[model samples]
Target: MLAFKVTTVGASSGFILTKEAMAKLNVKKGDTVFLTDAPGGGFRLTPYNPDFERQMALAEDVMRADRDILRALAK
Candidate 1:
């Protein structure tokens, strides 16, 4: 399910990402893609970001869990 067409770049229109969708969205050229907006409305390109958020959430959880240790270190 890959279909991109859009054209017209000078005026602000893109979507050329071929090459097997930039190698499964690994990105290369400019590197940085994140449409995001899935769920029911549909729309999710993503070259990361979401993952960063998830990682940040996990980090926060760990920090919270070890708050006591951190406080002790601070003092």
Candidate 2:
């Protein structure tokens, strides 16, 4: 696991990732990455996905069969 310290960025807080971590996330400078809280109470970061449309197509079928519960999740 990689450890990061919260650092100041012009009056806001941010974490700095090393070049290796950036490579693993498939992103470069100014690219958006998501940071979500883990089940164990830590944080997880990942690249913003491009295949979401395809995944949503599959989810739409499931959502239609059920209710729109899937929409409860924030995009």
Candidate 3:
């Protein structure tokens, strides 16, 4: 496990993640990461938001189905 020390970023405090940790998270600068409190008490960090991804996939299917209507609406 990687431990990060909380440091000051302007008025707010934050942790600086190392390059290796970022690589494991599959993220780069400005990328969004989700931090959730674990069941036991710890926390979890992840790059993927399953709900958002599923929503986007469903939206894509709808867009494909309604492409002609959407095209006319854009005018």
In terms of lDDT, which candidate is strongest? 3
- Measured over all alpha carbons after superposition, the RMSD of each candidate to the real structure, in angstroms, is 10.1, 8.8, 4.2
TM-scores, one per candidate: 0.48, 0.57, 0.63
lDDT string for model 1 (12-65, tens) is 988798899899988989888888889999888978888788999999999999
Off by over 4 Å in 1: 1-5, 8-31, 44-48
In what order do the candidates fall by lDDT, top score first?
Answer: 3, 1, 2
Of the candidates numbered 2 and 3, which has the greater lDDT value?
3
Query: Over the stretch 18-75, how does candidate 2's per-residue lDDT look in tens digits?
Result: 9888888889999988776768899777775436756988888788876655666633
Q: Which wins on TM-score, candidate 1 or candidate 3? A: 3
| Tens-place lDDT digits, model 3, residues 1-75 | 888999999999999889999999999999988887778999889988867988999999999999999999999
Q: Write down the TM-score for model 1.
A: 0.48
What residue runs in model 2 are displaced by over 4 Å at the alpha carbon?
39-42, 49-55, 58-75
**Candidate number achieving the greatest TM-score relative to the actual structure:** 3
lDDT of each: 0.89, 0.78, 0.92
